[model samples]
Target: MIIRTQVSFSVTGTHFTPSKVPAPFSDSHDPGVIGTVGRFRGAPVPYGSAGFEAPEKEMAKIAWIYERVSPYKSAMRDAGAEHCTLSVTYTYDSQCALSFSQEELKMIVDLDCYFHVDCQTAT
Candidate 1:
């Protein structure tokens, strides 16, 4: 017997504000490809069709998360003193899975999941 399962999650966190706005600003957007595989009974199965379409609204959400979290890390010697850490969070829905595979398990961690801002530091 083969069984299918669909898993989904969200990502959220607090990102420190950068001293200056970073270049190449990417609008909140979900990844073009955001699905994986699963197992049924005992065989490998695929999920969703090829070239899945992401929700338009999701793009905005993703961009927001990325922008808000960008300031958490500082590479410059004098990146403006940590101004403030902004709360960031986003949720991603995984495409349904029809089969299971070892590779699929490895990809689970990267799945679209909710993120919560726990804490942060400003220099």
Candidate 2:
């Protein structure tokens, strides 16, 4: 049952909350492909498409969280608990995703739905 939904979560008890940024009714494709509009060489560039300077934004919250916790042992784990929490939010067109892969289904389910935190820590 796919529906428009906004969900928030506390990252490892950190002060970051990934909230959903609602997409306008007339949204386009490649949400992560962030770019600016300008002239390249001689041709005009689009915003939604890739730009020459910046890279695509994927798992934005994860990236931000990494930046905050990169110095610690258990980067994510410790940051979410080491100091004051940071609030981070992410919005999506759909609430959740379901994948079909017999070999890796268990892992996907555990990480996605079960919230298994026993995975490997940052090295």
The clash numbers for all candidates, in the given order, read 25, 15
For model 1, where is the 10-residue window of minimal lDDT?
A: 45-54
lDDT of 1 by residue, 58-122 (tens): 53333343343334334211332222222232222433223324553333323322322322222
Best-matching candidate per TM-score: 1
- In lDDT terms, how accurate is model 2? 0.27
Candidate 1 lDDT at 112 equals 27
Q: What TM-score number comes out for model 2?
A: 0.19
* lDDT (0 to 1) per candidate: 0.28, 0.27
Give each prediction's root-mean-square deviation over alpha carbons: 19.6, 17.0
Cα deviation at 4, candidate 1, in Å, is 30
Candidate 2 lDDT, tens digit per residue, 7-36? 222222223111221212112222223334
